[model samples]
Target: MRPVDEHVAHAVSLMAPVDLDEVALAEAFGRVLARTVTARYDSPRFDNSAMDGYAVRAAEVTVGTRMRVAADIPAGSGEPPALHSGTCARIMTGAPVPHGADAVIPVEHTDAATAEVTFYQSAVTGAHIRRAGEDARAGDAVVAAGQLLGAWQLSAAASAGHATVAVRRRPVVAVLATGDELVDPGMEPGPGQIVDSNSTLLSMLVTAVGGVPVVLPRCPDRPGAVAAALAGVDADLIVTAGGASVGAYDPVKADLAGHGVEFFAVAMQPGKPQGLGTVNGIPIACLPGNPVSVAVTFHVVVGPMLRALLGAVEPKVLAAPAAEGWKCPAGRAQFVPAVVESDGSVRPATGGGSRSHLVASLAAGRVLAVVPAEVEQVYAGDTVGIMTSILENMG
Candidate 1:
């Protein structure tokens, strides 16, 4: 049996970040940046008032002293008349500060008037003034290469004056689920048949990592049929569910054997059956039929490849303490669906055993607590590696 990391490394060696393309800022969400984004102009662009107030000099009227209003400056006004001695400019929020004005006095601090305004207190220089380049300067690097652009990053890029961004093209993943006993949802099954959920699960998983998922129809266990289904699929990666393990009615591994596919058992529980090969010059990753196995293998092996193909970084894991004690399998590494408590303690989310076929147990947790192969027994307060179920925790 091969280690999980070794299989992931081999998968990554066959692929890299897709070509770069310019996409509109609206469409660039969740895409990895292909180049550094520099600021086109300084933030605030010019000195402006941060509040709706009067722009005036420090030598202006003291407490209860009335000063003549020289000009009215609203936002987007090209320029304003310079501040004359003993005069102030009526300015609105976000409007440029008039020349010779050193500070802003809020409208509330001035008496309501048209021609003249009375200040309740002396003005301080540079108060409530948003200076040019205070937030970010022109030509400064705002967004770095290889960074995934999300809502915050997109907002920052927009603030930097970017209408579009160069980002890595998303890889297309073909998801095919196998098993003659599998039937689509909302259909009545006769005798021994189950609904096909792995296809949609894998497709959603593929899309979670920014890859475009192309889900194909379910393939039967026949070798010829599986071979025909595997042929001529246009995708960067082909992911197949079922027929990967050593079973009597499984032909996914045998059908692709001639195409350089190698099926093996991973040194991990739940997802022991794993396969990798190239079919029609496209890389195919075979995962087990069980829903839980599909999820575990996809996150451990396929998630890394997706990250590598998108020029993204590896997921970060936290060593959280366990809230309860449990014995683990002797030889294989175990991954149990668990939730972190408010106290940051990890506990099994499922009220059942850690069986691969227990599909419903997968949704009981937000993270997967990992127990190494050597850990035969765990005690309360013991630390275990954590893998979050959500995409936000991946990076």
Candidate 2:
């Protein structure tokens, strides 16, 4: 059996970043930047007021010193006339400061009149003025290539005058859930059949990890249907859930074994049976069937592959203290669904161990507590590595 690290390495090795495309800021979320983003102009664009106040000469405004309001400048208005000696301009938040104004005294500190104003105290030089390029100067790098785009990144990019960005195209991943014992969710299954949850879990996981998930219909245990499904799907990556085991009805293994697929054993709890293959140069990753196993393996294995395929920077692994004790499996590494406490300690979502199937009971977890192969048990306050159950939560 291959080690979990080896499997993870192999999964990453099979994938490559998709082609880059220029996407509008409206559609940049969850995408990786293909090129470094530089500021086109200064962040503030020009010296502006940070608050609704009077823009005045610093030395002119003192306790009981009054000045005539030379002009009113609100945000987005054209440039106002220069400030004359002993005079100030009435300014609103984000309004450009008039030339010769060295400070902005907020309206709250004034007499609250529009035509004339008196400061409670002396105006500090450069106070409440947002200087141009204070946040970023022209040509300053705002974001690096391979960085993932989120709300903050998009906002910064827009502020940098980028209407569109060159980002790695979202990898299209086709999901084929293989089994005869599984039926569509919301449909009553016949005897000996259960509802299919892998499709739902995988598709959402794929989207969470920044991929375009295309979930196909469930494939039956028959060889012909499995082959046809494998041959017909078009995507950047192909993922088959189930049928990697040595069961009698495991058609994914029985039919695709020698047909460009390499079914193998991975030394990990709940996700031991795995397969790696390619079709027309597109990478394929086969995961185990049980809902919990499917989720765990995706977090531990497939999620990284998808991120690599999307050209995302490497994921950051975090370590936390184990909140409680549990029996760790022998010979195979174990990954249990867990909730990381606010203090950075983690505990299992359920008392029941990492059984290959128990997704229903483990739904509230946000992380997967990992135990190494040689460890036989865990004690309270032990340090353990963890994989975020929500793939996007990593880094």
lDDT by residue (1-395, candidate 2, tens digit) is 88999999988999877899999999888788999999999998999999998999998888888888879999999787899998898999999999999999999888877888888878999999999999999999998888888888889999999999999888889998988899888999899999998999999888888788998878999977777886767798988899999998898888778777898889899899999878656788889999889988888888889878777777666789999999987888999888878888998888887888777545778878889999999999999888766654524
Residue 393 deviation, candidate 2, in Å?
5.4
For candidate 1, list the clashing residue pairs, or say none: none
List clash counts for every candidate, in order. 0, 0
Please, what are the lDDT tens digits per residue for candidate 1 over residues 137-207?
Answer: 99999988877788888898999999999998999999999998999889998799999989888988887
Worst 10 residues of 2 by lDDT: 386-395
Q: In model 1, which runs have C-alpha deviations exceeding 4 angstroms?
A: 58-67, 108-115, 118-125, 318-327, 340-346, 371-383, 390-395
Residue 355 deviation, candidate 2, in Å? 1.8
Q: Which segments of candidate 2 are over 4 A away from where they belong? A: 223-225, 342-344, 391-395
Give per-model TM-scores: 0.86, 0.91
